[model samples]
Target: MARPKLPISATILVKNAQDTLQECLDSLQEFDEIILLDNGSSDDTLTIAREFNAIYGNLVIHTSEFIGFGALKNLAVSYARNDWILSIDSDEVLESTTLVRLKELFGTLDSKDLDSKTSESSALDSKNPKTPQTPTPPPNTLYALPRKNLYNGEWIKACGWYPDFVTRVFHKDYTRFNDNIVHESIMLPKDARLVRLDSGLKHYAYDNITHLLQKLQTYSSLWAEQNTHKSASPLKAIVRGGWSFVRNYFFKKGFLYGYKGFVISVCNALGVFFKYMKLYEATLPKKPRSCSLIITTYNQKERLALVLDSVRELAVLPTEVLIADDGSTEDTKALVESYARDFPCKLGHIWHEDRGFRLSAIRNAAIREAKGEYIIIIDGDMILHPFFVADHLAFATPKVFLQGSRVIVDSHTSESMLQARSEENAYKRVFTLGGLKARRCKILSHLVYATSRVDSKFFAQKDFIKGIRGCNMSFFKADCEAINGFNESFIGWGREDSEFVARFLFNGGALRRLKFAGIAYHIYHPENTRDMLESNHQIYLETIHTKAKFCRYGLKDL
Candidate 1:
């Protein structure tokens, strides 16, 4: 049979890798096309890539600033002309035999048949593409090759480094890397299959102890920064470091490599030790935080104006006010601008195109634009009490999210209160609500205190979550980033707030309920159609089932 014409694209990302660039390029000569994404290379890296491009017309070079490894790789994959992607590292050289095997595998397997087997039955019609969707990988096939690492000038095969299986070959439509700054890995569907190649790639990971130590510091810092929500202590770091050394040196049989094994083991322990130490350092006390009040609104200009007016009467004003407008009209913009003329604090309005209910996305945008270290989120319809800001600030605890209840105003009372521009009328309408708890909370707002509660369990109880309204909540920006803000995939209202609170708890954030402090009166409005509620509730249940802290399509993905 004739050799298959496999249209595979070899993708590589580099930064100042002049030394190993040529060898890595030479190893990938069999590939139909090679994509090189340069990350601001200062050395001869670009020169080498240009030379390769001249020699082999298959080379395509693109330059960009250094993003994280996962994001950079995803970008490079997007540029590939072919469906099959062969991801190669700058310091790794592919084996010639592996290339031959890959060609043989592709020759025997029909791509269309594989797609039919792997894809969902209701896969998108390629002929009629509407919205952008993530591509599904072809059935039962991603290629995993063993990687051999080189330490200094020697191949340290026995130091728990040999046969390092890495999945590098995949259909671009089905796989993408996670967006982690360091130690990023590809995420595959739950049922994807893996095929192992006989030949392996050579990884020139480190030149000497100096280079290894340098990388240890860099990777440790990235890991610590990524895990800001995780608590780290000195004793825990010491235990983890010692355990790592023991596990790698003894259990994994690293001692067979002699001095190399010992050095590798020690380095491994040190890396773990430093990672936790840096995490501990991050938890140290810092400067006083500035607060930003994020008010979410959707086309309710008059109600929003009332909320802003309430802000003007605050006992303690926030550093700034961020309006998370969910596709509101120009009139809402004008209203915010009108308030900005003499608002007590700086004012910002973040508005996206109206696309139904995108409350999560707008909130994320507002959070990103907010300059304050702490954020207080509320709805535009919820007119706040005078002491709301002061109360939130007083109870603001590190790594704890504050959830406050709202007093619902009936339609009759809301109309009367809106007609009358007095704060006293708003309070009177709020007190007339049927529930004694609401009346009591509103009457003794200053006397009642907040109660701290940590839900260590994964699942959110309905009664507990019912009180955790997004209309009145506050949290540290760092904690919000840790759980990746909110799941933007949540369309329409419903469980978005509860799901976020569940994730906040899942990521080690304490939950505190403000009984009387941070009180707000929820003005009556016609209920939005609950058509999407069941679907959104199912999504929340799934989140609880998976105990998901960070959503795949969250703030970072934006």
Candidate 2:
């Protein structure tokens, strides 16, 4: 049977969108009517829309006070003459085939089809008694249009960018926009029947870094406003903010986009960092929520004062700061004790015999002396964001054992830092054992060497977590002890932290990833992990997989 034609219109809300208004209006030429709502654009966007009206005759233009995004969209729908509406952004360009298919689908609807598609169509309203009885509608009520977004002058084919679907074409009465300052889209109920379209809308997001940064700053401000009541801790802010960058660039595959991708990832990390930092600065009170900060050092006195400075400046002060010195020959003991004398945070330091860099062992010693119910572990070279501690506790859950995120730092901040010891330092942290996922060094080695250059970069982002660096992570004290505290046998750098987390997960323990929460920055350094490529930890991988056994019993008695 041939389909019947239904009344339909295209409605758009624009404000200062001069450059892209023509593209949107031109695409709506075939519609019964093109309704454009202009919220006071100083540019030629309104003039251009008027030109489209003169030529296309069916275009209707409406103007109003510069209202919020949702209210403006809602006002545009009120002026729409047709019941069925297509809401499009000023930047969007629709394919010709899409318009043809849309008309064809609307014509074939019958009463039985309405019943079948009642679940998919937002227009099918049994809940609203005010809904007017209508003829049988098309088989599907809601149409899902995929989006091909062009970013940074190129279309992102990977990293979950392409063919992203959203239901934009729907009945105006059934859809409404949420009240939001940014990233606002139409909301449809769950029962709406969905139909996938063959073609997609093209979204040219942020043409360059300048646009990107501007948008980032806008969204970050909105985020800070949304989370207004949340207080900040300088230690928590700096530490967690630093890790957010690590996770995105390395673990999440932000580096695959190369320089552009790296910049975006860093921006994302900074978003998390600065949001909390600002929130802490504004909201922190004199009487802070007390917690314990644990730092273990081995010959890191040169950069220790920076860490202490960061700690002292935290918006929310900790009850105690425990520094466990693993026989640092260079004044670590004097440095910590001196600060202990003057600081409000009770300072505790444990000096052990000169042992190899057994970081896990030293951390375990500090945990034993911790006084606060909540415990945070940070590297000695780490700098704190103002709200670092506050964020962890804000989103902390009882079921979650290990909670961590990323921040932005490279070798630029501290030369004496371990991460800056070699050239591959940043690459290894971004590509290798960084994120909160299970990846074998041997498997990555074989693949990196065997695969083509593009393939390696592509697979790395999609398959791995991008930005988890060791210096900026924390977990509850009880949870740390439950996993026997970072695998004692897996001595010296690489895989020890990751391996312990894997063991924790395998034993009914969960890893809570604070992707956009706690962020930290990595100070750039020459990579110091070349030796770990062939370390004993590589051999330990076999034992972990063999019996499903996770932790060694050697430190169980501790």
List TM-scores for all candidates, in order: 0.49, 0.43
Worst 10-residue lDDT window for candidate 1 reads 125-134
Clashing pairs in 1: 137-174
lDDT, model 2: 0.63
Regions of model 1 farther than 4 Å from truth: 1-6, 108-140, 288-558
The worst-scoring run of ten residues by lDDT in candidate 2 lies at: 452-461
The Cα RMSD in angstroms, rounded to one decimal, for candidate 2 relative to the true structure is 20.0
Instruction: Go through the candidates in order and give each one's C-alpha lDDT.
Output: 0.81, 0.63
* RMSD per model, one decimal: 17.9, 20.0
- So what's the TM-score on candidate 1? 0.49
Tens-digit lDDT track of model 2 for 286-340? 2224567887677777556666766676677778888878778748888887888
> In angstroms, how far off is 150's CA in candidate 1?
0.7
